[model samples]
Target: MTTTAPAPAEAPASRVMAVPPAPAADAAAYFAARLAFHTDVADVHAALAAGAGDFAVVDSRSTGAWDQGRVPGAVHLPTAQIPRLARQFLDPAVPVVVYCWGPGCDGATRAALALARLGYRVKEMLGGIEYWIREGYAVETADGTRQLPPDPLTAPVGTDDCGC
Candidate 1:
């Protein structure tokens, strides 16, 4: 007797691609707008390392967090103090990049919003100090500057570039 083959199983529906991608022009505009409002840890580091003084990097976390560890050379301006102290700490003419604790934190966004309302061109650093540390960048602490090995999962090892 000949045996019949089992039927093929159906592929699972993907939540990721469930909706088709936007048209190219729309996607381009969307991404351009996003980039206009955000910068990543690596990009910020590169710019700072290059001695580009065109913009300022602001740490929007609490004092404790700021003292714990922060992006090297970052200005310590917490979200609550932005309104009262931003102008004193940062120049209104220079653009600003704000970051908080990490990707999970919304402190940077708040800081950026406050700065924008005050007429400063601002962009939120996408990953904050946590990502800076994770990406093996040196952080300024009370003791001094320290750097950790890049997390293999988040960044490439033994390489200067993420190859993005």
Candidate 2:
């Protein structure tokens, strides 16, 4: 009766599998594919100053707002009416830049989307008209608006940076 008790069953080997964490989605990539282009107010002004190709600049604000003041050569096409008038005023092949009241407004985005839906190459101008004014660019007004004389702080005299 000296038989030793059977050795305790060996515990199953613990499996240490290394599972990698899931990759995060790229926010820019996801949105970039959906949007046509992105341009800041300064870029748009530069493009205009450089005499870039016949791109259309559309002010997406209402008539009253546009009447108050707007980009010198911008065409008025309110966001609400873009779906109906986009193809009529915009060329499908030409690049179009859309802007609203200012950075706080999303009207430009809405207008851009509407133009894009109609097959127009469109970009929403970041900062909108407010930036345009703050940057010292000329704007058209009912009383014959004038561009603020170039100032050294704003831009060097006799330079294109004044956006005259």
Candidate 3:
């Protein structure tokens, strides 16, 4: 026996429960929130290199993971340490950008929320350090600094950026 796809009109309504997309105004609001809450690795690298000290970059991984490698200038502020140690190391006035291992992890989100609750402005780096390294950005380690070629699956292999 063979099966074929249903015609759009013939498809059951229950099988096509798609909601209309957000209106322009709603979409605008959504994009604004997205821009406000997320920053990508490339932009973070540019901002750090330009010395835009308006925000602090923080790594929210454990000490052992941190010792493995980290964004060069990121502060080692593990999520568990935030309440007890945020004030001592972070300035509430400066906005913060936090990252953890990668997309598979929520440590960055938890850290961002914690810092926000402590009255610090915060944004979570979307791809975290994994994407940072995947995109061929340098990471600081106990041995010094290292960078790997961009994983083509994660970033354009060469020739300028992805042109986004």
Candidate 4:
């Protein structure tokens, strides 16, 4: 009797799964290139209060917004007027910190770029006036404004020399 081996079992077909490629390194490089300095609202307040050498704060929001409220001692230039008013408020050699409405706004970015182009050292306040008020920092109002004694959550511990 012929002993023929049974036909080999058929193998299931294999599939080639498609996967999305990761973003190129150059993409991240490009983004990093555009990014400049960033600082939190509290640090900015402390720096201003501490009298950081020759540093100035510039508000990049509109006049109406500026009138509503702003960081104490911040000069309002507005993003549109940065080219003309930058030199008036900011010295090219000194550092200027720019801020707009809030963290989600980019108005400060444009103002910072304008200042940097004009040869001024500049940085953006990460959280702007919104965070400043939220963090319990003193904000000057048109009518009148006053700051209560610094709270533990808002200001650092120790005496005024704490160097927050």
Candidate 5:
């Protein structure tokens, strides 16, 4: 049997598209630092699963927000609480990956700063719990663990993975 595929959808509009490529050295340094400062949900999940990244995942939302949902095993270090309390839950030598509600929020960045000030290496999880749940990753709430179907717009809809 033969199957026909539908036409591809048009790309969405944006004010800024890809910029001209930078020089090789500049590009390399930028991306290397980008990786150093930021990670996405999938990579964080893989790293956590391997159990060897030597990084702590910190949820930098408020107590109410954390209680709403959070990455299982994530340290509940709210940004406001980090300066006074990060050392209580994090190792100085270990790196940290911090997240808040989603890309729309900057609480993770503030928390990262606080952790860094205290001398913990840090990276911010780019998409936060928003994309975690969007990509069907497990989250632990007071009630229990849960996940949702991946949104077709953000994730591959008909396959096990996007193969990216």
Candidate 6:
């Protein structure tokens, strides 16, 4: 006997399409600009794994959060300290990528704005440390470093890439 997959359930009419997508050229430009302003956790992990040194990753959360966990090599520069200590802690020549607690927190955005205003090129890391942890990347803590198994909801298990 042969079996076939069931048909997918019909989706509700989307409020998303209520406003039609922008024209292709406009969409391309918008998306490109967005990429310039944001970097995702996966891309950041790949860059770090490759030992790329062109940019700096910054954790913009507080001291307690830093103690809890952080990207392995991220600089512990809380958003409030970006003004006084940014130039001292970071090289002006390097591009900066900032991440905060998670999608719900705007600390990274505030840090990015502070860095940009100080004449440094910066992008906010989308999804922040929350996504970083959720993706099963190794995190550094006061105790040491540890990596969790990939969270199936956020990342592919037993695969090299997400195929996005």
Each candidate structure's TM-score, on Cα atoms with residue i matched to residue i, is 0.90, 0.68, 0.88, 0.67, 0.84, 0.90
Ranking by TM-score: 1, 6, 3, 5, 2, 4
Q: What TM-score would candidate 4 get against the native?
A: 0.67
Q: Any residue pairs clashing in model 3, and if so which?
A: none
lDDT, candidate 2, 6-118, per-residue tens: 99998765554244433456656666664547777666778788888768899999999998789878888999999888878877888899999987988998898888888
User: What C-alpha RMSD separates each model from the true structure?
Assistant: 3.2, 11.5, 5.4, 9.0, 9.9, 7.7
> How far in Å is the alpha carbon of 66 misplaced in model 5?
0.7
Model 6: CA > 4 A from native = 1-14
Residue pair clashes in candidate 5: none
Candidate 6 per-residue lDDT, tens place, 1-164, comes to: 99999999988779988789999999999999999999999999999999999999999999999999999999999999999999999999999999998899989999999999999999999999999988999999989998888889999999859998
User: Per-residue alpha-carbon lDDT of model 1 for 19-85, expressed as tens digits?
Assistant: 9799999999999999999999999999999999999999999999999998888899989999999
Q: Candidate 2: misplaced stretches above 4 Å?
A: 1-36, 148-164
- The 10-residue segment of model 5 with minimum total lDDT is 12-21
- Candidate 1: list runs displaced more than 4 Å: 1-13
> Model 4, 49-153: lDDT tens per residue?
878866788999998999888898988898888888777777777788899998798899899899888888888998788777766677787887745555566
Candidate 6 clashes between residue pairs 3 or more apart in a chain or in different chains: none
Model 5: CA > 4 A from native: 1-20, 158-160
lDDT by residue for model 3 (1-164), tens: 99998766765556345776788999999999998999999889878888888999999999999998999988999999999999998988999999999999999999999999999989999899999999989999999998899998888886536777
**Candidate 1 overall lDDT versus native:** 0.93
lDDT of each: 0.93, 0.80, 0.91, 0.79, 0.87, 0.94
TM value for model 2: 0.68
